[model samples]
Target: MSRFTSICLGFILMMVSCDERDSNPTFSHDIAKIIYHNCSPCHRPNQIGHFNLLTYTDVKTNANKILYTVKNRLMPPWPADPHYTSFVGEKVLTEKEVGLIETWVKQSCPVGDSSQIPALPTFPIGSMLGTPDLHIPVKPIRLQGNYTDRFLVIKVPFEVPRDSFVSMVEFVPGNTKVVHHVNGDLVRFEFDKKKDVYDGSLVDNLVWDSTIRLVYKKIGLLHDDGSYPTLARSVVNYLPGVIAQKYPEGIGGWKVNRKSAFVLADIHYGPTVDDVWDSSYINIFYAKSIPKRPLQEFQLGTLGVSSIVPPLIIAPDKISTYHSSCTITNDISILTINPHMHLLGKSFWAYALTPEHDTIRLIKIPHWDFNWQNFYTFKKMLKIPAGSTIYIEGVFDNTRDNPYNPNNPPKEVHDNNGSMRTTDEMFQFIITYLPYEEGDENISLE
Candidate 1:
């Protein structure tokens, strides 16, 4: 063979080998390593996540679902701007890692070798450890197989010799698989007939009626007596993905008077009611000694809006804005901020401007997810100067492209009150902070 021909043939063979290697379906250690590091924290046994992804078979069975969720940036849901600051336990997938999973799924999800699998990551069983100071469980109730929202009120009873304070709290779902989301409220008034309260309350009449089926509905129920609604003077909410937040020093604890009655109800939403959920519980943590600080949550904007036109409509390729503001009177430490919106919400950004016009970016959720929203807690205390103005802006999309749009024809909606309807939208911003003084109370903008 001629020297030139031999050289060209050898080069072509090398090129073919490289292309074959790149296209191969073989799993790399890198792929398994990333999953173990990022997903196993909550996706393991006895955890809040619905499924376990510890083994190769576990990942293979749910391969396509995993890819779709990750590519869409839905699962391991962390809502923060990656460019600004990264959190300690943030769950974001890199481009290369996402591509690797997509390629592996297309290549038949090959399990290269059992021995090559890395050890699953470990996470501490927080708040769940040790016996709870108090546990409140709801009565067992059968969810009717109809499309409706159910509101239930359960009253929890506790006997306190003196005023007590709460430091930490946890809401442990009896059936994490079925409970969509639960909200906790502190009610000082006690009812003699709890069942009647559940049946006749305004919330029950509005949510639990039998008219609508699959579209939207709510159920109302309360907790039982042996378990008192876990009471805390300072901390008002406790749920998974919510962290242990403390107030600034010298703020002191919340006041829970002795012999005072409390009610803790769970607002349960069943997208599709297939199973019967009877026993759900929430645990409350109390400190042996009261701390120098107390946590307080302030509602910055108006609770209801009055608009002549529907405020929340967004047409195809069109943009709409929702604005709300809150004013601060005294210097304080902001522990966390939560932004709430209905299905049409797209993006949210919030900032605080001092009286001098200097601004501080509190938080920004670039892509909003209604299902996984929570109070974004700051790692360190954020001190806001006294007399600051807080501003929030949220954008919504109402066109057909928006999968969450409630309306079909896309009509213009404006009403006197800022209540959400076919054509209207509502806006709200909640901030949790501690007043600078020991006995300083919250001053609301509304």
Candidate 2:
């Protein structure tokens, strides 16, 4: 054949191959696995997802919506920027995968071979950390349909047969819709200090009064002899998309007294229009052995060890940025970090600089979504040198243009002395770590 004729045939073949490739992609073979693995975990029954994405019909119905969100990087809400640093269980889709979904949706969501569709994955029923040694039920809370947020201090009392070492404390929200977040502390009473661990009233409404002593007394947190019991802060926490934080065996576990209680220092439930009841619970997993290196934690900014550089105040109709930093006095292996902000949050970032001037990227959320705050765990332990300085920057948009701004005219907002109210602003970076060990840098947190 002549050179021009040969070139014409090659071009024809290439065009045919491209057409075949576009036509062959289908829902059963191409899209099921992605949704099953990434979206279904939250989109199924009794989850935070608004609707089910479990079947072919469901995908077909929402194909356009799904395509739009993936294109905009909205759905499967992972706030951590993968480019800055990666964490375990990241749900980000690749550019290629996003293109495939786009093409499939554009082609009318073909179901080429229904038989080839992968089976729906099975998820744990109650607890994500497997069977628990003890299950402590949180007292059920009733909420009115007045569209007002409720903050409650609750005590979940329990008595184990004997003092036991616990590796993990898992908080499972019974009402995913209304339950916003939880911060729990462990209260251990001396075996002989109190006759009954269950004698106190279970709950107290924080809105009525927030006086420390009165709240404690109203909730029956004091012992029979009118003395304070041992309290461990941040034993368990819960947010919308957060998986329970479980470290490797013997890394971080706390001992529970025979007579103990799990005090939810404050549990926030979002405003609802319909009256509902929430019955969240806690699961305790016994440790195989005592913790070899107990986990320690500290925070930067807004009532933490470090203070916000320009203070956390945000003026109405304005955008502002604030910074905070803290120097590490001791070498530590950092496990997990949680960046916290409220409705007005725009962006967040954190990093550490060593004395040698080497920069260590910790986490960066270029666009902040208040609904999906998470405790981001590192894939492996991150070692910060003793002289390293960790810095954090947060941006808040209080202008009317900001859709999430709670105020219509965008009134002034600030961290009201580390207030828990959603409308009030807060900038905090909480780090959980352990003193550095010989091979700590090589340890995997997964």
- Best candidate (score: TM-score): 2
**Clashing pairs in model 2, backbone N/Cα/C closer than 3 A:** none
- State every prediction's TM-score relative to the real structure: 0.70, 0.91
Model 1 misplaced stretches (Cα beyond 4 Å): 1-29, 41-51, 85-89, 94-113, 116-130, 147-157, 189-253, 259-266, 304-319, 410-425, 436-446
Give the per-residue lDDT of model 2 (tens digit) for 235-326. Answer: 98998667788899989888899999988877888888999999899999999998888888899998799989898889999889999999
Q: What TM-score does candidate 1 reach?
A: 0.70
lDDT of 1 at 255: 53
Instruction: Give lDDT tens digits, candidate 1, residues 1-446.
Output: 99999999999999998666546645445457767877766677755577987878788888899889888877667776755544334567877677777888888887776687776655555344456776755555566657655544444434455567655555555555455555555533233423332332223222322221111113222323422333433233434444444444334345554433333333455444565554665565666677765667766443522221234444545558777676777898776677766566788888899999999777788887666667666655567888997888887776677776656755553322433232244455777777664333342211
- lDDT agreement of model 1 with the native: 0.58
RMSD of 2: 4.3
